[model samples]
Target: MPDADRQDATLEWVERVATFCVEEWGLTPITGRILGLLMICDPPERSAGQIADAIHASRASLTSNMRLLTTIGLIRKVRVPGDRTAYYRIEDDAWEKVIQRKIAGLGAFGDIAEEGLALIDDANPARTERIRAAQHALTWLRDLAARHPRDATT
Candidate 1:
């Protein structure tokens, strides 16, 4: 582990990441903290209690957040032999999986925009144009990511 001051600074940075996840991505603060902690915690795995103490979250909240993260395959719990406590670590490809899922979800928006375009009458092309623009954006994003899967990992 780093020295106390260094650790504190890192934790502060982690909290900023959690705040971004909460405000921009709609993730629970605790969940975001867990993700951020797993990414930087020394030794690469941490018990629930250790995580709770570091993030100033309760055990109960950590339990639920860990469960959700595990269910989504973002993190995993490992049991050490002769030890009862579960230690959690972020998946090696967690960000890749997350980005892939988001990309897949964006594809659905194209379908939605297509349906929206069908709803309006042909006489009002302006409305259809707006819907078309939305679909175009989604397609551009989807194609751009597909073209450069390597960049998406970063």
Candidate 2:
């Protein structure tokens, strides 16, 4: 494909990723765009101004989102010696961190379900069924994750 075609395709794919992040992960479109761009951008790192330009977002909006991503471990700030400009790059294990957080959330919900079960009186199956099902599903997923460990070198 020609360079222009490849660039267009890449932008389309990035938009798709942005949509997924918005609908599934509750992230802002700009945040998703930043992630999408960083994942495929050359050199694996870009400065704040460059990121803002690439995603068509304002520096004002990008600042908070960048801070949030950095705090959450999805991305990090890098400083080149003597440049005084802070660049951003996706973490090497960003996806793993995301998955780990999701699994932890599931486990938290399972604990909440357990508490709900304890609140039920007289061992009522009907009252406990929903909570039990939730707990069971979470446990199953946790077990599955444990059984199939991710390879360290991805």
Candidate 3:
């Protein structure tokens, strides 16, 4: 494809990914746009001004989102010798860690469910059924996340 067409296609994908991040993941549109642009942008790293121009976001917004992303370990800031500006790039294992963190968070819900169930009187075990079921589901999911996968070659 021609350069202009390729650029248009890339932008299209970025918008789609940004939309999903906003709707499915509950991230702000600008943050999603930053992530989308960074995911496909050349050189694997871009300065704040360059990223702002690419995503059409203000420097103030970029700074806030970059700080949040950096704090969460989703991205990193790099500085070159003799240059004051920081370049940002996605973490190599960002998505994997995202999934792991989500799975780890489920453990807390399990604890909550167990506590709820414990509050139910033994004289009425049926009253605890709903909480018990949710606790079981969470337990299963936690176990599933921890278990090893089967070999595809087999």
Candidate No. with top lDDT: 1
lDDT digits (tens) for residues 1-154 of candidate 3:
9999998998888889889989988888888888888889889889999989888889998899989888988889888889987899988877776777766678679878989987887777777887888898887776777683222111
TM-score of each: 0.90, 0.90, 0.86
Clashes of 3: 0
Candidate 1 per-residue lDDT, tens place, 1-154, comes to 6689898889898998899889978999899898999999889999999999999999899899999999999999998899998899999999899888888688679778878888888888888789999998887778878899879667
Model 2, span 50-146: residue lDDT tens: 9998788999999999999999999999988999989999999999988878877887788788788788875678877878999889867666666
The per-model lDDT (C-alpha) reads: 0.89, 0.88, 0.82
Error of 1 at 152 (Å): 4.2
Candidate 1's displacement at residue 22, Å, is 0.9
RMSD of 2: 2.3
* Worst ten in a row by lDDT for model 2: 145-154
Which residue runs does candidate 3 get wrong by more than 4 Å? 122-127, 149-154
Candidate 2, 154: how far from true, in Å? 7.8
Alpha carbon lDDT at 93, candidate 2 = 91
